[model samples]
Target: MRSGPYKIIIGLALWLITPVETFAQSILRDAETEAFLHESSDPIFRAAGLTPQSVHMYLLHENSINAFVTGGQNIFIHSGLILAADDVTEFLGVMAHETCHIACGHRLRRGEAYANAGTASILSMVLGAAAILAGGTDAGMGIMMAGQSVAQGQFLAYTRGQESEADLAGAKYLETVGINGEGMIRFFDKLRDQEILAQVRQDPYVRSHPLNRVRILQLQQAVETSPSYQKPPNPALEEKFQRLKAKLMGYLYEPRRTLRKYPPSDTSIAARYARVYAYHKSLEWDLALTEAKALVESEPQNPYFYEIMGQILFENGRVRESLPVFKQAVDLGPREPLIATAYGQAMVSLEDPDLMEKAIPILEDATRQDSGNTFAWFNLAKAYAWSGRDAEASLATAERFYSAGVPMMAVMHAQRAMESFKMGTSEWLRAQDILYVSQEAAEKLEKQRRRQERQRRLSFED
Candidate 1:
């Protein structure tokens, strides 16, 4: 309470901000995976005195072994990192560490360092030029090299300090949550081998996280000395972790590879869940349907199984069948926005007047539940359009584009929506707000583009 916590922005830009080094990974959405991540990380967030909802976590379809927090409370995790984790504990360890970075204000501190680093680099070039004028070319080059070395040293030293701080803080959070730091240390051990590899070959996690031998040893010693380290593992949690990994493996790997790993002989729940996707992806519709049916039969109450069945059936041209399956999923997990969005989308695809009318309320509820979901917003726009609410559709489209960071498109739609609504009305005001915000964002992007263009021209001249 003593700390002044800035308001967390809930929108597309924050959720899908630039990756670590402008991470190019695409954002992946899944209802089940998101639920799993929140369930695992919520306790750690609470223990760290942070609200789980205030901190948004996004899954990236990235193969690099990385997880990083950016734009304050946003954490982007790579799929490779999850698959690389041997178990849930290891994955949670990374989550705790990233959360600790937010708790400790590392992002703000790092931002300060970056600003200073740029100034130092520019100052060094000037000093280097002065040396060249006073002495010779060699002397100037040497001055520049030394200056850069000092600048780089300062940044790396500060980063290492923060990394060490987060490591200890993460360990404390784990202990507070009654989870042992053994998994934390084990994950570190897994990455320790990367130290021997050449820098270019190192995983993004190792590169960005910067794990020195001393820090690793200190972390290991601290975790081992803590009483929580002796705590027994949770079998139920481990089972969930296994299934989470299995699902990722099925989705990430080739169908051939997944089938090989979870062959016909394998009848475990994990294998069954994985083969459902593998068979679906590999175009073996019958096998996929069979596996999905088996899963639903085994866990009649599980909403996710119904979701998968609905998706498989819908994608395979069994639209009517999928409608009921998707509806079942919604009935079971009514609060799940993504599932509801899917059901709404399926209803829209049918183009039936009755179905479209029904979809309007469902899509509206989905968007109301999670306004940041672009998919839901898009579906809602379609439903609104079908219901002869063209202005509402335009407003919804504006909202969708705004949340997707497409400011120009948002501005265009917002303006159109504004034209249709009377002044002083809520819809008109909202349209005006969207138009203003999106126009500003669009202008900012244009300015950046111009600046980058100027830089390129200068580089060409040099």
Candidate 2:
């Protein structure tokens, strides 16, 4: 499973309920979603009056067009919505709403509410609607609770008010960021319409969020009430958004669907972007390359176009060509950690030791640029080890996996630290307290996993 704080418990439960092969497929993609999440959290946090310094986001490989806050820190975005959104503004709107929950202390407030609800009332509710929301049958509820420990149902049920507040605050943040608050209204409206078209089979974001005339009116009010707002003239960033959206759409939808949705267009680059990803996904190497080459020709100065070039080349096993394309991409958007990571990887693959050395500082800079990036941490660790910096390499590798939400890696490295201390060598063990805590966490998770397995088997017998 992907290295997420919630994964250890969720993974075991999902594993029991889902067939093994299905779960494995999801686990692989979940890792990338987690990485995208780390990359995207900062702006949402900053927009919602929270600190990006410690915030973490994880993308869940759920197909439902919904999102939820599982705990105090983790915001889970559905992969479906991530792929379907029209642009980053739309994606950020979803994130900003969730961020509002964190900023306003919703998790803390939910705990208070759950306590006030008392044990029996919480259990009754959990056995009722919570079971439905969680796909837990009446009997399954007991097994589910055994793993969750806390009242997971109560936590979600009690957060309805918090979700509402988040919508309001998120809209305000969108305005602050100079995003058209209409994006929120539009997106919500789309979801509301979708629920209606599906005859309300969808979950109650529609029912709870009720897209009454008042909702859009309030969003408009928030947008107008905020200080004078105007989206900055950023064609470059907008192009990046388009490209990312296109790539995601291609990956998410069938080729025929993508072609239909993004039909060829000369005025808007969306279609061209879509074609690149669609052809690439189909493994039509010649077609994808042809489309990409044309795009680069049409937009010669657009650095994002070079990013697509680098992606195409690398993905098609042209690592040698990918390196130079990635360099051009970095020149175009040095702040983008994804492009920099790609460049660094290409350098590493070619065994250009000096280039890889150069790439380390660059990758390190990328990690610092987005301290939450697990990918950067992983790359930096590998570069360090290959360059003969064992101590820092271990620490970096541990930290990399640690930030990605995998406490196991943290615990593993913590053990390494303990070993170094035993040797009375490796100056890296100077600060071992955090490592000690990680060790305890890993043990706790192992215990939970064992407990969950017992429950699953017992339930199966029943």
Candidate 3:
């Protein structure tokens, strides 16, 4: 199943009942959507005096309206928030706020407090060690609750202060970039009503950010006072935003809902995009093909239209037919890592020796451009294995596993890679690095197991 451009691998039974933490296990990794997010956030990041490329954006598979900055330069945004946003500016406003948290070193300061309270080490252990060992057991729940209690109690006030600071800082960034700060105010205003709801019913953003009427008023005042308050929205940007939202709706929502929202009466490109996804999801391949071909005809130069068509054809068991479409997308968007990755993936899927050889360099280049791309690494591994490059294939598998946070598997593949490579070579050294990290992860897991066991024994005695 898919949700708003993200593939959901968990079974429907598990997916329906899974908690938020379990949902975090899935990640959405579309190249085009990620690229668009980066572009939208670049101005805000730059205005905050941070390099645009320094912070990485991750779209979580969950459907909660929230975005958060963690211990590192990673920003996680839920696809629900994206779909919920009214416009590009509204979404960008959220990005600006998260970037403010990172730029202001709020996470670092909080970490320092955690360290002072002797919770930092255990917190890290909870994420890596306890998570690996306990899975969803009571021990795991206790550990997580302990960490959250400490974090919430010790830093709640500080975090609220930071939220206000981020709001002001984000408005300043939008102003500096000539974007209307009203969008930020408007988004917050929309959430203001959520403050009155029960805690469990409130959106995650409301719960995390601590929204209030006073804050909304202050934000509105600040935005109205900004010189760029009346600036018009960029037409091109708005178009991209519309297309992205449509694409996501088509992929994520139920086919019936999608078709209802974008009926046959709606002939706009965005409407067509949604219908194509709906048709594809409904297994109406003929209708999907017709809509996709129409999209291609309407926007011959748009790489995304071709990309979507290629994806539909490829997924529907038309490998040979999909190749030319994917190539066209790559040719149109040469610098696009996602398009290149898709082309390479298609080639690797062909299982032809010559095609696999051709795919390797493309996959390699795509991975080089975006090292965080799991799809590229996985396909690159397939390409390598097909060409009988066992050592390289093992290394690529290790990379894929490492990126997916499966350090044990990563270590296994790294060990295999080491056996295939000569001593003192670059590949051997890289394998050694993977082995070292994975071993550290293993040790952490063991520590967490011992800690949980001791706790369980103590409880039993009591």
Candidate 4:
């Protein structure tokens, strides 16, 4: 039941501190992590009266602990925050806070305020320049100061107010969802001293989120007053969180570091998950397969375990062996677009015309379920190409590029697709949509390029 690919940020200036380029490039996508996050945040979203399916959550590749809401219903969580959380509750608390931000319309209101402030600031600057030219230095200085005050007030004061509101609302949401709100208090307490740290050393959360002793006290009081304040942690949720952390650590950390972190002595499921990835990363395919098989045996019904096994085998050119494992994973997690995509990918790898026919339908379904998955679109294109569905293949290629953030390429392929399909056909209409969006993306990229060029020229002039 995947909704769609996240709306790529592109040149959106959502965060004041984070540059548009940095924000766009820092996004990381993984099926397992996304699924886990959705599972964890679903309750908080529900409590906030938001449809969990409509809210897209993304993981930022940054190592600094941070989370923020932007672009309406999107929440971006840094990988460092996930790794740093002591338990599932802490992570859930963060999710609750971010969800509350979205539910409260904080970002939208803040964005409007900022936009208005920016307009005022520009007008003031114009007046200030006119005053200076007229030899009224005092008036110019006063006008400039007023402009700065407006910008600063909008940026800092408005955001701080929003932060406080999100904290209160988030705690209430967690309580309403039957989750302990104390986790929010504890997480803030852990970072309370961070306010005193040097800006360079401070976590992104500390910089972006205004926190204080009073705010912490307020959260504590809220938790104390809530009836669900002392709710026990769910074991299933804890296990899933641990496995997610292990998976992230294994994939992101150095192989040596991952192996050392989860040694042979640690025989837990999380340990096994980490080691499997570590072995795979180190190119020890045999060892990785052995660990993956052990995991499948331990959790026979766990689709993720089977996914790891299939991945190891498929990546090592054991397509025949990988096929059944992928199928099993899909059968267990039919609704998971990633698993279904993987199964389709395995079928495509067989390169048989008959297999391509089967792969096409599976991949089409997978892409339909999760339109943001570039890999699924890629494999779908391959299947289509093999089956001589040239127009569909071209359209799929366009979609894959679009999801991967290559707008010019997407536009080119989409145009090619347009030529292959009959006018007013569904395929032709899809290509038209892709072309329209991709052209807009191309324009955005060009504007960004011009801005960068202007900045560079100004820097050189200075």
Candidate 5:
């Protein structure tokens, strides 16, 4: 009920948007994200004493070189760390660390502490972020809580004595997995070096995790004592992992630098990775297509490889071509919300309004799958808008935009719906009521707009 400027904007953004029914069906399904979760058949899962429910690894798009555990069921790894690793062993090392956290029940303790402290507000934020990381629906609810309640002190509690516990646990897991703890040491060393150069002083991981010289020293000692701490010869899987890492780096790095680091070679898949980025960065659509085509040909079964091709084609505005590639990806592996969302977007962009009948249910599935997928909501909003169901469309668009962190777009959609209600039929008035807007404000805005338009034309002529 507050009349402050910010409150007004929030109110409009939350409730009053025009019904753009066409934008409702564009979210990525849970099946998609579920497919992308990390799984391994290594005996270490059991050897490390990890219950199946205790260790669920997720791949997040965050570029920061960090990995964290939110609770017993969720271990979040940043994509940047995966891309930065020299081999699968190093990647596994990070997993081992997070796994240690779960095995030690640190995350579970944090949750218990927060609840017992009556810090429901801070716990709400953590739960929200955790939900998105776990690929769950209602992720936006988490974001809303995060915005209202996140505090450095509360987050610091997640780090207390937990880092050392994970380091030791990871070292032990490496032993059971027949992996050298040295790999873990190597990855931690890299992170330590990064911390010194970071202008921000606190890397996202370091801020949340209490990494220190003592922690590093302790890990080194663990590796030194661990039996046969030797680097394993890179396996076939390592090569596949490299290709995946390179492809990701290609997207993140400048083309020239990527090419220099990953020179063209017949045997090296990194070259293809570099080329994909090069062509894309250079805006050479045809060349990018050629590179992507070659990549898909060589790695036919890798869904991630297809994702690269689909991304290239999509960025180049070849929506039709992009659609099939994304579809191929979905067929290859349907659990990634990103792929499904992209596929749904392509379907909507193809100009078949009837196709939305197909897309809406898919997006609903996606939202139910993981409510944090803002892009899916965005595509759904467009679908709804074009379908002439303005009320639902506006709400969907507003919510999608809000989830995407685009407050302006959210406010615009809300305002559009409010205006439509004022100008259109009694149906518009009915819809406005549903949107939670007052008749007095709606009439005032309409009157203000009419006066402004009159002034705009007169000023233009003058």
Candidate 6:
């Protein structure tokens, strides 16, 4: 059975669940969704005097309304929070607030960036480490929590003072970006209503953010006084936000729920997007194809529509049929690496050596741009191996393992790669670098194992 945090599940291929004891949340990853988030959040990051590349935004497959900044430069927003937002401005507002947490350095910094590590491994740098300190479950620990354990205690909740500071800082960011602050206040006003609920019933945002009357008043003052408080909404982003929410609803919600929410009468682009995912995930391929085809007709130029159609066909044993659709998607030259990776993956899946010539360069480029994508690396390895390039295959396999946080496997593959390459060559040096990092990561994991055992013993005694 396929396992680990990086396993490619069906549907739109965004659901990557990270098992952390009893605390698990799916980390959604899609090249297109990530690109949208990066675009929307880039301004706030810039306003905070930070580069968009420095801070990464992650979407959690959580229904609770929460967005948080942790470790140093990572911001995690629950998909539920995105669905809850009334408009794009509200979504951006939450992003702006989280960026403030980073800008204000509300959490003490720890560790350095692992530039090549994949999604789950990246989270392992922060939440995974924090989960370990909390004595996280042993299940899938090797894959999900297999990186440096540098941070402690600060990811879940922030001090009231910090929350207040972030609130004030967030308003300034929206003003700096020439966006309306009404959305910020409106979003917070919704959070304020949640405080009346029982603690367990309240949203995670309320628990983590510590909303007080004074803080809300200060937030209001900071936002309302800004010159950009009444600026018009960006229509394009607003439309995209609707689609984003629709896609999340379709992917994460039950098919029945999704169809009910966006019935046949709702033939809009966003509604069709939701239905396609819902139909495909429900194993109703015909319905999915119909919806996907309609979506392509509605927006012939849109790469994402084609992407969803390709995903549906690719996942449902129609790999050959999906190729032309995926071709159209990549031909549009969408900036999303995942779409290209998916296209490359489809070609490699055919297991035809003749296709390698066409597949290899696409996979190589996708892997180079998105080295952290384990799926891309895995496909590239398979493509190389089929084409009789054992050395390249081994190197790609090493990268896949490293990206997935299985350092021992990575080290082994890296060693294999090294033996195939000449000494001091670029490939050999790359293999050597993988070996070094994997070895160091393995040692740290060994230490973590010992610490976990002690913690288990202490818990048993208690």
Query: Which of the numbered candidates is closest to the native, going by highest lDDT?
Result: 6
TM-score of 4: 0.83
Candidate 5 lDDT, 1-462, residue by residue in tens: 112321211110011111122221111122312332344314445666866644555454446676666534455556677777877777777778777666677753355435533344454455545444444323323232332223222343456477788888878887776777777777777777655655365555655665678998888888788774885834755665776576556655677877777766543566776677666766777876787778788879866667767767776777677777877876786666556676777688776978776777667666555455666777777777777877667766655654543334555666676565555676455334433322232343355457668878988999
- What local distance difference test score does each model get? 0.73, 0.57, 0.72, 0.72, 0.58, 0.75
lDDT of 6 by residue, 344-445 (tens): 888998998887778999888887776666777888999998889999999999987776667788899999999999999999999998888778767767
Per-residue alpha-carbon lDDT of candidate 1 for residues 1-462, written as tens digits (9 for 90 to 100): 011111111110112222122223345567777888888899999999999987777676677687876435667688888889887778888888888888998843345445655543444445544433432222233333333422122332237888898888998898888888888788988898998999668776776687888887878787887878878656777777788777877776788999898997998878988888777767788898888888899899988889888877777878788999999999999988888887887899898889989998998898878766776788788888888999999999998776655668889999999999888899999899878866765675566567668878988999
Worst 10 residues of 5 by lDDT: 8-17
Ranking by lDDT: 6, 1, 4, 3, 5, 2
lDDT of 2: 0.57
Q: How well does candidate 6 score on lDDT at residue 275? A: 89
Quote the lDDT for 48 in model 2.
73
- The parts of candidate 3 lying over 4 Å away from their true place are 1-25, 108-158, 453-462
Shift in Å, residue 136, candidate 3: 25
Clashes (candidate 2): 0
Task: Give the alpha carbon lDDT tens digit for every residue of 1-462 in model 2.
Answer: 233432222211011112112232131122223344555556657877677755645343455565655434555455566666776666777777778777887653345545654444344333323332322121122222332222222245334556567778988777665665555666776776554556347543443233555555666677666563344423554555565566556655677888887876543576777777677667787777777778778888765677677767776778788888878878877776656766776677666678768879888877766554555667787788788877667777666544443456666775665554444544355326436544554565466567668878988999
The C-alpha stretches of model 4 lying farther than 4 A from their native spots are 1-26, 108-158
* Comparing 2 and 4 on lDDT, the stronger one: 4
**Alpha-carbon shift of residue 193 in model 6 (angstroms):** 3.4
Q: Candidate 4 residues 42-80, lDDT tens each?
A: 988998999987787766666778776543565767788
lDDT of 3 by residue, 343-397 (tens): 8877888899999999998899987876645567888998898888999999998
lDDT of 5: 0.58
Off by over 4 Å in 1: 1-23, 108-158
Which candidate, 3 or 6, would have the higher TM-score against the true structure? 6
Return the lDDT, model 3, position 436.
81
Q: How many clashes in candidate 6?
A: 1
lDDT of 1: 0.73
